[model samples]
Target: MVLIDRIRYLLEKLLEVFTIFLLLALTSIVLAAVAFRTFGSSIAWYDEVASIGLAWLTFYGANLAALKRAHMGFPGIVSSAPPALRMALFVLSEAIVIGFFAVIAYYGYHVFEILAWDRLVSLPSISLTVTQSAIPISAALFIVCECLTLPEAWKKMRAGVDSEHEAIEEAIRLAEEDLKENRS
Candidate 1:
């Protein structure tokens, strides 16, 4: 259990770092493209590359959000429900999310395979498979994140804890602390 927790911690941290890098890369690519165009020297592959970067950013950002449980949800009822009901609802919701991502990942793999031979027009050296690969990769990441939360959900359920509310409150508190620190 300790090993699994450690692995999860490391994976989440890695995802966080990768997501930050993607954001920075995306921002830099866009800014560079804009500056080049303004200077009357546009890069032919800038659009294609920036689009791919944006796609990757969106996919990986979503996966990171899942890892943080930052996805939007109407958990009001669940948070106020009885322990048994809350547990059932949480489990059901998680199962649905996992199943949805599983289907996406499966189909995404097929899409990536089909596009493997197709290259981007502006960047003939790069295959479409490379850009489209983000779908399956992100889906897989999301599935892993969701699966990792299952044990915690089960433990909370067994302990009759309002984990959803607790998590939300904890996030709010952290945000407040960060704001205060920044102001200081």
Candidate 2:
């Protein structure tokens, strides 16, 4: 359990860092495109490259969000539920999400297989598989992260670690702040 938690924390941090760079790269591409367009010599591949970067950023970001359990949900209703039911609902919700992403991860690998031989016309440096594969990769990582946190959750049920959701929410909040600062 300790080992899994450590690994999950490490992976979550690593992915968070990578996602930051991908976002910055996307921003740089967009800025360059805008600047070049103003001078009437827009790079032909800037848009395409930026689009691919954006896709990677979006999916990877989603995965990171999932790991943190930070994706948006109807918190109002959850908050209104009875205490016992609320906890049950939370577990059920996480389980359902895990199931959904597990399926996504499975099919995502197939998609990667189908697109394995293909390359992007504008960005040949990045294969189609690399882009499509993020889905499954993220799904798999999310599952691992959730699973790692589950034991701790059970341990804290009496005293309530709330660690899984709380930690994710905190991480997401920090990431959002970092993003805003970077944009500024």
Report per-prediction Cα RMSD to one decimal: 2.8, 6.3
Off by over 4 Å in 1: 157-164, 171-184
lDDT of each: 0.84, 0.77
lDDT of 2 by residue, 1-184 (tens): 6787788788789889999999899998899899999998978788777877888888788767766656677545565566787678778877897898899889998897789788878768878887677788878877876776666544555344454566679899999999999999
- What lDDT tens digits, residue by residue, belong to model 1 across residues 69-124? 77887566776688878878888898899999999999999997778789999989
Q: Which ranges in model 2 have alpha carbons more than 4 Å from their true place?
A: 74-84, 152-184
TM-score of 2: 0.73
Model number with the top lDDT: 1
- What pairs collide in candidate 1? none
Worst 10 residues of 2 by lDDT: 154-163
